[model samples]
Each structure stands twice: as structure tokens, then as C-alpha cells.
Target: MDMVNPIVLFVCFIVLSGPVLIVAGIIDMSKGSGTRGGILTVLGASTMGLVYWAYSAISHMNFSKGRVLRLKGRARVARRALGDGWADDATPDIEGLTPWQRTVLGEAWLYSAGMEHASVPAFAKLSLKLSAMGAPSELLEACHLAALDEVRHARRCFALARAYSGLPWSAGMIPELSQDRPQRPSPAEGDDWSRLVRGSLLDGCLGEGLAASVAAEVSRRASDPVIRETLAVIAEDEGRHAELAWDVIAFALERGGGTAKQALRQALDALETQRSPSLPSIPGVDEAFLARNGVLPQAELGRLMEECIQRTRARASSS
Candidate 1:
């Protein structure tokens, strides 16, 4: 799941351009070269069709901007949390891989890094909002730790991206954000309770739960030992992150009661609409190749996603 890099999109569009051929074919026909013109016209129409397909696929295969970011009106990756103690010394084994494989893997990790980078602030804000609601110190502490873990996750993915692509990409910067707002985080208030519940249910529990499941599958499928090991570590961390989300929901339900339950139900109902559409067919990223490189191919990813969503709903209902 790579971010649709605008630069790549532009390059692809140019390479797939059919207008020039079409226009030339029209000119050739006006000059009495009907045979050549007919051939060119047919080729041009076919090329145009291919171009349309490519554009559709690329647009549909957009980035997985995590749900937490979406809840806060920060759906786009902010590219903050600059380079520091983010990467590890572990080397990703990229030997014997085709150039396209390397690229597919690199972009996958790069997109993941962006999502993880966004989570740092997401957790920080969660902590602040919880604190405003007079949440327990343990919950606050977990939020802080989760933010740190996201920093580590982003670093690992960034390191892997650089390793696979030989590109010098870093999480852009760390912005200064003040968590001290004048607003009271009172759980007694209806609006506060609803916001807290919605955030915990949609962003935390559902989002992180799905993330953990997907990472586990990716880890299981990877043939590259180093990549497998890296994802294993990440998958384990994501499981804990999902637990923390549930913990938040648990606390919210305890204090907010029926109001919280209603919010949870509303959030659960919204899941179907929010579920990502099936990924489009990507170039050089077929089912077999992606599975071996720690990436779920489109079909596998779709199935896993449905499973995760169903599991999340069951868990949320019981909780």
C-alpha cells in the first residue's frame, strides 16, 4: 500500500500519453495516408484505453492513511517526526530481487512509514484528550509509550525503505504541538463522552486491530528472513497497540455508560462505509511476488481485511 507519489503519477501519465499519437494519426489521414493513419488511429485508441485503466488503478490504490489521522482531520501524512533514533541496525536482504520487486517492497514500506509517523501525534493527541477527561494515569502512560513505539515503527520502516530503494528518505520533521488546551475533558458532558467513545472505538480499537492482523500475515508470508524478523517485531508491537485501544474503550464505557455504548454502535455501523475499497491491480505487484516479499497481494489483503473487520465488530460488541 504505497502512497500515490504525485511525481510517479506524473511520470506514468507522460509515458502513457496517447493524445500525440491520435493527433498525428488525424494529420496523416488528412495528408492522404489512409492506411498508415488507420493503423495509428487504432493503436492510439488502444493506448488511450490502457492509459485510462492505469489511471484508475493508481487512484484506487491510494495510501492507507490510518483511521486515527482521519478522525483528527489530518488524513494526509504530515511527514513530521524527523530522522533520529528511528531506524535499526538490522539489514534487509534485498539480494536476487528484481528491480520492480525492490521498488514494490520499498514503496510498501515507505507508505507504512508514513502511516506510522502520523500515529506518533495521533497517540499524543489521544493522551491529551484522555487527560482532559480525567483518565487514569496508567492510560496516559500507555498513550505516551504508544507514541514512542510509533516513532520506532516509523524508523524501522524508513530504514527498510532506504535499504530496498537506496533512497535517502526520512520522516520529514517533528512539529512542536502543545497539548495544553483550555477545554475541559469532562466525561460527564454528552459531547465529550461521544467524542471519546468515537475516537476510541473507530481510531483505536478497529484501526490498530486490523493493522496488527495485517502485519502478522505479512510476517508469515515473507520469505526474506530479515524482513520477516522486522515485521514480526512490528506485528507484536501492533498487537499491544490494539490492546491499548481496547483498554481506552473499556475505560470510556465504564464512565460514559449508555452514551458510550451508543457511540460505539454508531462507530461500528460506520465501519462498512469506511472500509477501504479493494486495491487496484498494480504494475509488477502480482499475487505471488508480493506475498514472498512481506506484502499481501490484493486478493489476500481484501480477505484479511474482511476477517479483521468482522473480528473487530465481534470484539467491540462483546466488550
Candidate 2:
């Protein structure tokens, strides 16, 4: 939060990435994207071996997993984005790139598009959760803005995917995201405070903290100027999102007393899961090419994830 405390805001951003990838894979399978689906399924499951060693009550509103609709052939819809500011519709130059190269980048961006698109609804749901709890206007407003940021993010990623893949596709519908959404905490539910605490800790702090770090790192290393800038923007916004989670967790702890504190303490055990990278290597992808295009290898990203966890531990100890 604004001040240092026993609980730190720095948590694993990619801590839940394994599960997300697995969920994405399942969705991919449903969409008949066997190549990505199979890969995501296997890697996601294995990554969970590193994760899911603990951290029960992982679903604070089921974490809002989103689905991407893979449309049939060249039918693209017109996109009305949040606004035309910065890289709203920017695409990387593919002047010297091969078709296969484009396909690889496209696939990577497509997956990223799904993740970003899902976040749009996730933030909207978070705002609902805050409103039911009667949170501050600032928090509520931030959620709305974050949702807009995600919308822009999804748009750009989809555009990049379209450019690289040479496909006329955009984001698909996500009815289930709203349908199975977590309801606001009714008075009868009673444990709303705990839910808020854990949700912010795991999802907001850890998740976005790791996200900000990874995006920044990827942006820094990426050879493509447009990709670098796009990630830089995402990195900055995700950093703010991480801070919002910190503020939310801090506020909950202050108000919810032992229940909230206890929730936070329990989620802290997630730090112990910090060990080696769990994901297997991609079979046909060239590591250097992917890196140049802004896609870091799974193992390297894992290392960055572990580093974030370690940094959190150090900061917690010093604080």
C-alpha cells in the first residue's frame, strides 16, 4: 500500500500463469486448435506441478477465465477500440519476415490476445466485487480504467496476430465470463473480507507484479520497435494494477482484522513454491527468433517469475 507493512505488494505475476495457460489450452481444444491446444495443455499441466503444490481457495470468483472464439475463414469484424491514442492499432513491420515467421508471431500474439481480452471482463468483475464491498470511489474508478487498458491491449494483440497470421480475425465472444462470474458478496456469505484479501494478494499483487516485470523485460529485449512499445505500455499499466492490488490488500487487512490478515498469511506460502521452471520447450520454434519478436522462452520467463518471488521475499524481510 502507501506504506510498508508485513505484507508486501510484490507477488508472483506469473504464479497463476500455468493454470491460465492450461485453461487457455482447454479452450483451445474446444476450438479445435490442436497444435496450440495440445501444447498448452501439456505445458500448463506440468507448470501446475510447480504451482498447485498449495494455495487453496485459489478461485476468488473462479479468477474469470476467458474464451477466444476462433471464427471460420477470413471473416473479420470492425473493431471500435477504447480510442486512437498511441499504439491502438500498431503492427510490427514484417518486411524481412517469412510466412512461417509471421505464423509464429501470429500464434504468440493470438494467445496473448486471449489473455488480454479475458482481463477486460476480469477487471469489470473486480469492480463489481469492490462496489458490493462498498470500496472507495478511487478503487472503483481504477478498475474501470484498467478494463479500458485491457481492451486496448487486446485490440493491439489481436491486430498483431492478424498481421502476422494474415487472417481476418478478432476477439470472440465471452458469454461464460459473465455467466459464471462470481457474485458480489452478499451479507449472508460473511467471508467477503477474506475473499477480498486473498483475491487481491494472489490475483492482483502477485499476478500483476509478475506481469509488469515480464512485460518490461520482454519489451526491453524485443527487437521489434512496435512490439517493444506495445509491451512497454502494458508493462506500465500492469505495474499500476499491481499497486492497486497492494492497496486493496492493505485496506482489507486494516478493516478485516485477523480474518484478512490470516488470509494474506496463508497465501504467502505461495512464495515457497519458488523453485525451477516447469514448462517444457516448444518443439519446432526457434528460440532466438521468438525472442527477437518479443516472445521470451518459457524457461526464461520462469526464471523471471522466480526472481520476482525472491525479490518479494527479500522486500518482505527488510520491511
Candidate 3:
């Protein structure tokens, strides 16, 4: 409401309506009923009209006479979360990721990295959208950063999956990252431990365990020296990642309130039900890699998962 230049307000209207139109068009395409498509088209057009009307009404209001008070709140929130002021170039270069790790990590990471990469601007674009809807700037900035991290993690995991599958990494059908869409207003539930575990435990701990298992098995099975060496290196990293997850969970539990404790318990329960993403059907992947690496037994993978679970459980019990 900073009496945003009229042009900025107009552009915002377009940006907000674009997605609604895209979805309506998709629904129209899916319908074989000619009448259904017409109905959807009408609905979409009506939505666009409503949005334009609202924008026009707000734009004409005198925001200078304390009518713009909401804008001040949003700016304050942004300052709190983004710190000092927004930076034009806040993107950080991720340098330590090995090329192979970057490639294969994407496949495994797609499951949860939307949440993980919540820090990225791409993911946070929605939060920026909400800021326009009267959300504080700090909250929007927090959302933005969270989306950013999730997207980057997705990129890393996809890179790893590509190497494993021998297919070039692409976003393809990956779901767009989400933040604050569920509309929980309670602070404690929003901050709960179970959500923490769901967000962190699988990837941080069990996921790493699977990686290590695959690596160890690959070392035993692979005849090709390159394959063996690659698995060995990747496995080492997975092991470290799993350990890091455990440490983080522990720290979160110790420092966190009621939500963290409950969430940890639930996360431990989920570990029992966890399964790895099905290995892609690459040429010779079954015989050349999985069988040789002892992953064919499948039970071995279960055992590795169990080991990770036990470690997590023990940490929780101690806490």
C-alpha cells in the first residue's frame, strides 16, 4: 500500500491472475464435454474480472491518510526476516557439492526438498505474493529463504539421480515448492516437533543410511572400477549426511519446546514404514549395479533402514 506506483499495482494484478488462467485452461483441456470447457472458461474470466475490480477499488483509495498502515507492518516484517534491507544479489554459491552428488541427490531429494529449499526466491515468490496480501515483510522473507533452500536442494538431488539413472536432470513433473498454504494459526502447532521430524528425519537420517548401504553394496558388486569407485565416494558422503541429521535432530529436540518432542516421536514411528525411491530402470542397472552391490536382496536395504531408525530412537530416548 506504499501507494505503490500505479504501474507496479497493475503488474501485480497480471502476475496474480496469470496462474489462475493457466489452471483453468488446463481443466478445460482435460474435459471431453464441450459444455464443461465453456463453463470453466467463463469461470476463469469471471475470476480475472473480480481481481481487476478489487485492484481498481484499492488503487483509488487514499493510502496516505493512515490507510497505508498495513504497508508499514509488511515492511517492518520484511526487515525483521530479511535483515536490514533486501539485497539484489543474495544468492549464495554452493561450492562444496561434488558434481556427482549434485546430480544424483535430486532424485532422492524431490520427495521433501520443496520444504528443504523453502529459502529460495523461486519458492518464496508465493510469500512475496502474500506480502502483497498484508503479510509482514519478515514473515515473507522467512518464507522466501525457506523456498530458496528447498529448490537448491532439489537441484542437488536431481543431479545425483541423473548420474545414477544416466538421464540428464530436469525438473519435469516435480511439484512447485509450497509454504504456509495450510493456514495454521496456532503458534505451538505451527512450531511442533512432529513436523520437524517429518521435515528433517527421513532425509537427514534414513535417507543417508540408504545412501551408505547402496555405496557399501556397490563396492562389493561392481566389476567396473569406475562404478565401484563412484559408489564408494558417494557412500562416504551419505554416511556423513546421516550423522549430521542425527546431530541436528538431537539439538532441535534439546532446544525446542513441546512440538519438537512430540514430532521426534512421530518421526521415529515413520522410520519403520520408510522405503527408498524405486531405483530407475536404467540399462543393466539391475544386474550391473544393484545385484552386484547386494541391493537385490532388498532385505539388506531394510536392515540399513532399521539401523538408522534405531540410532534415531536411541537419541530420542536419551533426550
For model 3, residues 1-319, the per-residue Cα lDDT tens digits are: 4454333344345446655664766677686655666666667777566544533432221111100001211211111121211222212222344332322222232222222222233323434444444544554554444444344443443333333323343433223222224445365334534444444576555655555665676556755454455456546655654554565566556656677778777677767777533322322123333344223334455565566667766765676
Each candidate's lDDT (Cα)?
Answer: 0.70, 0.64, 0.44
Q: State the weakest 10-residue window (summed lDDT) of model 3.
A: 61-70
lDDT of 2 by residue, 8-58 (tens): 111122356678888999999999899999999888887665434322211
Pick by lDDT: 1 or 3, better one: 1
Please say which candidate is ahead in lDDT: 1 or 2: 1
Q: What total of clashing residue pairs does each candidate reach?
A: 3, 4, 40
Residue pairs with backbone atoms closer than 3 Å in model 1 (clashes): 81-173, 86-155, 132-185
- The TM-score obtained by model 2 is 0.68
Report the Cα lDDT for residue 42, model 1: 80
TM-scores of the models, in the given order?
Answer: 0.74, 0.68, 0.42
Cα displacement (Å) at residue 276, model 2: 7.7
Greater TM-score among 1 and 2 belongs to 1
Deviation from truth (RMSD, Å), model 1: 6.6
Which candidate has the top score in lDDT? 1
